[model samples]
Target: MSGLIGRLRGRGRPPFAALAAGLGLAALSLSACGGGDAPPANVVATGSAPSYYPADYAQVINASKGEGGTLTIYSNTDQENWAPIFHDFQKKYPWVKKISANNLDSDEVFQRVLSEQATSGSPADLLVSNAAQAWAEFAAKPNALMAYKSPELAKLPKFAQLLPNVYAMSVDPLSAVYNKTLIDQQPDTLQGLADLVAKDQGKYRDKITTRDVKGSFGFTVSHAFTSARPGSWAALQKILPLARPETSSGTQLEKITSGEYVAGFFISAAPAYPVAAKSGGLLKITFLKDGTVVLPRGVGIAAKAPHPATSKLFADFLMSQEGQRAVAEGGLTSYRGDVETRKDRHTYQELVSKVGESNVIFARYAEVPGAEVNAFVSRWNGLLGH
Candidate 1:
């Protein structure tokens, strides 16, 4: 039971069938690791993963030393946030040097991976992003990623099961963010917020902001609204009159932080934003009636990683309780427990507090999330009037 939840945090379960599916995946990951040879690198798009090779399996375990090469990680969260996570990771494995090669936008990371894999050379050895669903295509290919069960798997709380190879680095929950001084009352539920928006009319018409759905955080809000709406996403169209768009979560965060807007839907990737809010940083947030859409961004290693052993070692550390907690406490969502609200007036309150709780993790559903998200993004791209 203890390993059941955090281990499977991002997994969609409750139905017996879902649990069975999880066991099967775990078994698959285990079987992959048992061999010495790594799986071939073409199974990224198919349902079945490549078989693990004996030599490759041994190599991954030895990679903890960062011997042959380095681990390249990419993510959209600001560098200011990865400090603690990176620091702790380095401290854990001094030999495994992490090359924080590039900080990318959510919209661009996937395309970069595709381009890099197609021409530059190999796909990134490790990827940490809000766009894991985009990876399903790669997963179907043979030996696209190396699967391993790290020792820290026990510290993972519960959500770790859904994504056997991916570790939730931190919590980035999408919530309704408001200016504490400007808003008279915070809406606790969806209908309540809908009424508030409609009543404010002109005041909120262009004042409320969000990232365009073409990106990760933006897609989250779009998905939530669509799910909450009836018959069609058309129900959310009414809000288009009041909605304005940004290319990143940073813009919306700044608007709310500056008092330029009373409320905006925030894709809180950087915990610094929320910490700023709690520390009298002007912004405050709450899950809309449907609850905040939690994205536990994380890393996964490629099976053909030239440095497969090193990649596995790095991946293992990233999932360990220490790695998850360091990032979670730093303000991003934690996969193990609910974020311990700073309940203080301090910037980076979550980080300052050193997270002690585990939060639920969520992911972009592989089958439906990709196509479903594209449809929504295109819809917004063609919003009647931007």
Candidate 2:
């Protein structure tokens, strides 16, 4: 394990402490979308777990167990959120002696993984990131990520499934979180927020908050909205001036609860849900009626992963019913229709039902062209004066 770590920790790599701090900030911001309710204790699997795997699921597991090795993963997911999933995976596959996991910023993960791949060293066996654009851009390189179509993909919503190599593990929808005490009237749609900002410009000035589009995760989301939603750029331009831009959703939520900011837009439901649920109704999350952008946590396997069999097994496990439930329990948005949670929250199906299928924009990074992304980023930088 030390040898593998040393090999990957080559020249030009930032210290783990620095990576953690950066990732901690990004994770705190991204995880701000969490739900308030605790996941049910006895989450019943939709069906037999083995059934979700391919016909040779047992063979894959057996092979992985036979060829024992450490499985290293590079991810941006919070440790608390991923602990349950990792625990379950270990319990299921005891043959794998150790699992080395590192939490880093999405950009750092991309760079480190790319460097490791280039050296033909022990790169990450598995890669998980919220930055969809990074994964999409990586997919363009031949053999950058392994291509495996899990049987569980058939069970996921069409929107959750990305390229054959990349799969959406968690579906975090962007919503509006407001301080109920400060804002008497809640806007049901983005347009409504725009109107409020325009009509009562003085009242809402410096009262709204959102991700900094210039930042990594923020750019991915803002860019997607630009490409997917018509006139969204115009809406953003009208609304951002009223918003106090911040990179961390935790910061946004804190200020909103403190009455420093009346509302926050484009907030992930993952972190916001739990905070609002526990806020004694002081904080509330609302899915925009016009449309809600679902930011999926993209999971993929490195093409040159050392523990290929184990990587495949783990990836397949993540997409299983049990894994999806763990994802929801971990406070992420579950994309599986079979999974259900507390009444206060909207299941994947409920979200689609309430918002209408057309209004739910799944940010498929693979589908977005690079030129469009550059244009959007340039415009966003100009608008934000970054």
The 10 consecutive residues of candidate 2 with the worst lDDT sum are 5-14
Per-residue lDDT, model 2, residue 144, is 81
- Please identify model 1 stretches exceeding 4 Å from their true place: 1-63, 66-69, 154-158, 161-164, 228-238, 269-275, 278-281, 337-363, 367-386
Shift of residue 229 alpha carbon in model 2, Å: 3.1
RMSD list, candidates in order:
13.3, 7.2
C-alpha lDDT (0 to 100) for residue 360 of candidate 1: 19
What are the clash counts of all predictions, listed in order?
A: 53, 15
Q: Residue 192 deviation, candidate 2, in Å?
A: 0.9
Question: In angstroms, what RMSD does candidate 1 have relative to the true structure?
Answer: 13.3
lDDT of 1 by residue, 18-86 (tens): 333233211112122222333223112111111332445445445445454355654454544455555
**Per-residue lDDT of candidate 2, residues 202-283 (tens digit):** 7888888877765656665666666677687667777877776777677777888999999988777777877888899899
Give the per-residue Cα lDDT of candidate 2 at 122: 51
In angstroms, the error of model 2 at 252 is 1.5
